[model samples]
Target: MELAKIHRLDISKYNLTFLPRKEEMFAEMLEKVDADDAVLEALKSVFPLPERNTDVLLHGDYWPGNILWSDGKIVSIIDWEDAWIGDPLADLANGRLEILFQLGKDAMIYFTEQYKSVMTKVDYSNLPYWDLWAALRLSKFTEWELDENILKTMKERINWFISQAID
Candidate 1:
């Protein structure tokens, strides 16, 4: 709700500017992944999206840890450094992926529903593109910081999550 509200704010009056859209960054990162040929192709197809209105303010890093709570209700949503002025789907996709990994697919679906319930007019055409973008962005989970068992589970989940986007 808070994120949707943020997106709804009339920030058009401010002269804020964001860097080039993230597709270029996604392209650069994709080259290093050694992903399956089909997966790579699917990702490539969505890039250089046709120019359109990018009015919403994205909470570029919308995930669990950034949401703060006191008692029970959320008191704050910290971490604004990654915020950007772009497609609202970026935040929704990233939030969905985080929920899938931290909680489960059911929770991710519920969260998506809650978000959409507020953002009634959102066009979800690029949701798959952004989901794959998020999955790639968060591929750092494949790192060595976690124990082997946890890593194994997360890797499998990541692959499944990727399949969800591609299929």
Candidate 2:
């Protein structure tokens, strides 16, 4: 429904004036994102320490549509795009938002708890960063469109993300 909502909004007229230049963003990430140090430490502080036997699973585009449901339960998953070895919890953030969209915010807590019971791979506390990152990425993908409403919301969301990072 997020895509549907985006499609309904006129995305052809909007302009995100404060978006960082693509090269600048990439350069900053390259300089600051130390996968072995920064990300690992962040993950450790935010999630349960990985068990010795834990295995990394590639979850490409792990979200709701890829999650199949049967009789009100998720019975399967789909989609293989962008699937690679890393953190599956990264996808949980997106899944959380999707659940909130489909089942409402009130259901999110319970849904999240259930996910934790099953995945048991990461904590939910720091997932917001990943979720916001995904949302910002999505917004950037459509940032050049002409939709005023879409652009405004995208700008607001992206700016909000920048503020969070800065603070």
Report the CA-based lDDT of candidate 1 relative to the real structure. 0.78
Q: For residues 48-151, what per-residue lDDT tens digits would candidate 1 score against the true structure?
A: 65444465777788888899999989899999887776788878988998888788788889999999898878888778877887887787776659888877
- The C-alpha RMSD in Å for every predicted model, in order, reads 2.2, 13.5
TM-score of candidate 2 against the unseen true structure: 0.46
Query: How far out, in Å, is residue 25 in model 1?
Result: 4.3
Candidate 2 residue-wise lDDT, 40-153, digit = tens:
344335344333222233343555667687798766667755443334444555555555444555565676676666655354444555554444334333436647775565
Clashes of each: 0, 9
Find the candidate with the highest lDDT and give its number: 1
State TM-scores per candidate.
0.86, 0.46
Best-fitting candidate, scored by TM-score = 1
Error of 2 at 1 (Å): 22
